[model samples]
Target: MSLANLSRIARAEGDPKVLQTGRSSLPTADRVARSLGWFSIALGLTELFAPGAIARTLGLDGRKGLVRAYGAREIGAGVVSLSTERSLGLWSRVAGDALDLATLAPALGRDNPKRRAAALAFTLVAGVALIDVVAAGSATAVHARAPNRRRNYRDRSGFPQGVAAARGAAAALRAHDDLATARRLPAGSEAKAPAVG
Candidate 1:
């Protein structure tokens, strides 16, 4: 019923070759997530500080306010992605991209002189959104498959059993030292150590 026993059972049911030998120390997938997070933060900062430039580039000339609002959303998504698990954060980015494309749809009107620019921007956003979707799915799969092997009190390498293990090891070393010391004495010597009552 304990968590450790459950983990053991799960391991027993699975292929031995599939068992993870040790903890992940910076999984490549996680690193990709973090990189995306930094990218989000950078893009967010650019949008927030230069809404007018972004509006001009995307051919949303008079929609600086809308662009700035989107920037705020970007900043929020960036923070979430960087501070937590990648799945949620990347999904948020995907949602943000959808909103971005929706907002740009009007700029693609036939009468719009900057329609081509808007289309290019939309294409770029769509591509990024695809990446976000893939990354989110990957992150989700990684998270789900990852074992919950938290260092808990019951585990020997964890904190709870620390004192007991240390004490046992120390006692073993002390016994070995005492035997060695006794053997070093003269062959006929009767060493009488004092015992405190």
Candidate 2:
């Protein structure tokens, strides 16, 4: 069976059916943010699992713990990016990229044997940082609310009748319920009845 058919099998009778599937309706910036989130998670896993390898490759000797810490940070940012708070996550990633650059700068020293690798890593991080900045700005702009916009809900009362009428109906319903409860009780239950406000 098709994917939609499979989904339909699990749905209730009155649930809306899926007619077809297509590209996501998310905005371009949001899509980018999502992609970055996945990237962050993958990279974080790598760093978390192989901090020693990463430290050796970058010539940041004895910093395995730090690399692991950064990995945790990446995973946290990734989770946020994949959630409704994409802008916040992207901004956090930009901050992380700055930290990565600072940490890698020391690895570029003349005495470091992996200076070239460090430079390459630094360049890649800088590029990703630029993308993060762009994605964050775009996402923020796309999700920002208009300052002067005001919502008009003058015609809505959330009930078929007006508010006052709805309140009166609710009181009548409550009174009816109380009467029904009284009828369901034993003869002397009124003496032990709970007080109502």
Instruction: Highest lDDT: give the candidate number.
Output: 2
How well is each residue in 1-197 modelled by candidate 2, as lDDT tens digits? Answer: 67787887789989987777778679999999999999999999999999999999999989999999999999999999999999999999999999999999999999999999999999999999999999999999999998899899998889877787766443323332567774666655544544433
- How well does candidate 1 match the true structure in TM-score terms? 0.60
Q: What Cα-based lDDT does every candidate model obtain?
A: 0.76, 0.90
lDDT of 1 by residue, 126-195 (tens): 9999888888888778778548866565545644556666554323233324777756755333324332
User: TM-score for all predictions?
Assistant: 0.60, 0.76
Q: Which stretches of candidate 1 lie over 4 Å from their true place?
A: 1-24, 145-197
Candidate 2: where are CA atoms >4 Å away?
Answer: 1-23, 154-170, 179-197
Worst 10 residues of 2 by lDDT: 168-177
Clashes of 1: 0
